[model samples]
Target: MDPAIEAIRTFNRFFTRHVGAIDARFLDTEANLPEARLLFEIARQEPVQANLLQAALGLDRGYLSRMIARFEDRGWIMRDRFEADARTRPIRMTEAGREAFDKIDQRQRAAVAHDLNRLDAVAQDDLVQALTKARLLLDPDAPAEFIIRSARIGEVSQVAARQSILYAASHGWGRELETLEAETTAAFLRRFKPGREECWVADLSGTMAGAVFLTDEGDSLARLRLLHVEPFARRRGIGGALVDECVRFARDRQYDRIILWTHTVLDAARRIYAHHGFECIATEVHHEFGEPVQGETWQLRLTA
Candidate 1:
């Protein structure tokens, strides 16, 4: 099996076991995990159509009908036919069912708290971030909340380290690239100007997803440097967001032109630049990052 698939399967097994999801009773409740989940969903989205519930949970029609029948037998829920559509029935929880759901919710919250309290604040945050990213990956259609903000203290080092590791892993670049990134970041910080130079970090739902830098190069010229996005966070318009932020900042600072140096192999970044009206103005061959590679300079003219 593929490593990714195996890893996911392993995590599923561990999580199911950890949560007692395979047990006959969930959180010591009378209902099993699936039944408890169904009850909670009904309580949360009451008056929701049975078809909608089935679609949302991806449950089989027959299986869902049986679960609904069980809930009805327990006097926890009622299915009422829609006035306009006899075939469509909405599910609602009874008073007893609502009470049961509340109890289950309390118990689940307690269980989660018990587990999370074992970890420190940082570990809890890491767990939450990991889960959020995993959920986003599983649901590509979900909206991603991205923020382009000023780089926080110590974040410049983070940017350099991330860029170095990612380039090394993906493109087989060597320590030369790492050294260059570190030096550039350090130099920018040493000579940083509040209004003229800026570094922006792209944050996606509490995770540092990407970063970019803009520096004054004199004579109305601004240089864009060290543009990078995390590999897993690509294709989500993060690269574009970073570039857009750079251009906006440059224009606000009254720079006439913005320039950047990048290699030819960075097709995605190049595409984002081109989309924002940047033109390639220079090219050369450089063996700075281990292997021979074509280097290109892209420039964009800022309009007043």
Candidate 2:
């Protein structure tokens, strides 16, 4: 009767019916999971660093090397040393690989759509709504495989600088810089409960591309704070993963709510928060750095 076991069974059933067919038709024909994953990564047309892929997929170095080798042999992807750094190698899909991946993607989408179409319009909407809510609710209490490890203390300053610059530039914080006291910023971090606060730096290969933080505000509330992804890490789902970790941590701790702060200028962070069912509950114009700025508060309720 355990919920975890029940969820596992539910997923196993779903995967058995949906995943088996897709895997057999697409992945089985081309290669194993690793190869197919690499193919998809290359097909994205982004110069993916090998170490990034390794961390994202959580594969052993030897296994990833073997997977890349197979793709190289098949000419599905081309590996090139990073232009800025010869030591780092990034990969991209070849023209032929793109064409192949398109077919595979189309087939998978169609296969998934076919089943969804079986549900009536209202039922489909209901299903989607239910799933979205379930995900947020389940996420807060989920066990985390990744731990909040250490980060360079300097990165905190770097992240804050980038965030403030970007925030000010986009949001017209002309004099706001004067209001943002370094002491206040330091205090915010300093307030974190030592035993409960956690920070994780996501190292994409050798690059520290993103960071996330979780802070316990009270017994029933936790604040997911200071999630930042470098410009280079944008669109890679790094931000989403970081937020998800915070949500999971809160859930595991039985927190009733998870809260975060942002200004209107941070659209990407707002979107991620919205996607995870966080809603803006309060807004105010505050003076910061000698400039007036609008700040927003958002909260995701973990309990119904």
Q: Write the per-residue lDDT of candidate 2 for residues 107-159, one digit (tens) a residue.
A: 66787798788999767855764554455345533322232344666655655
Residues 1-304, candidate 1: write the lDDT tens digits: 6999999999999999999899998888878899998887898798888888888788998898898888889889977854666328788899989888888899999999998999998899789878877876687556788899999888899999999998888899979999999899999999998899999998888878899999999999999999998765777899989999999888898899999999899998899999999999999999888789999999999965
List residue ranges in candidate 1 displaced over 4 A.
1-10, 83-87, 137-143
**TM-score (C-alpha) between model 1 and the true structure:** 0.86
* Sliding window of 10 residues with minimal summed lDDT for model 2: 140-149
Supply every candidate's count of residue pairs whose N, Cα or C atoms clash at under 3 angstroms.
Answer: 0, 10
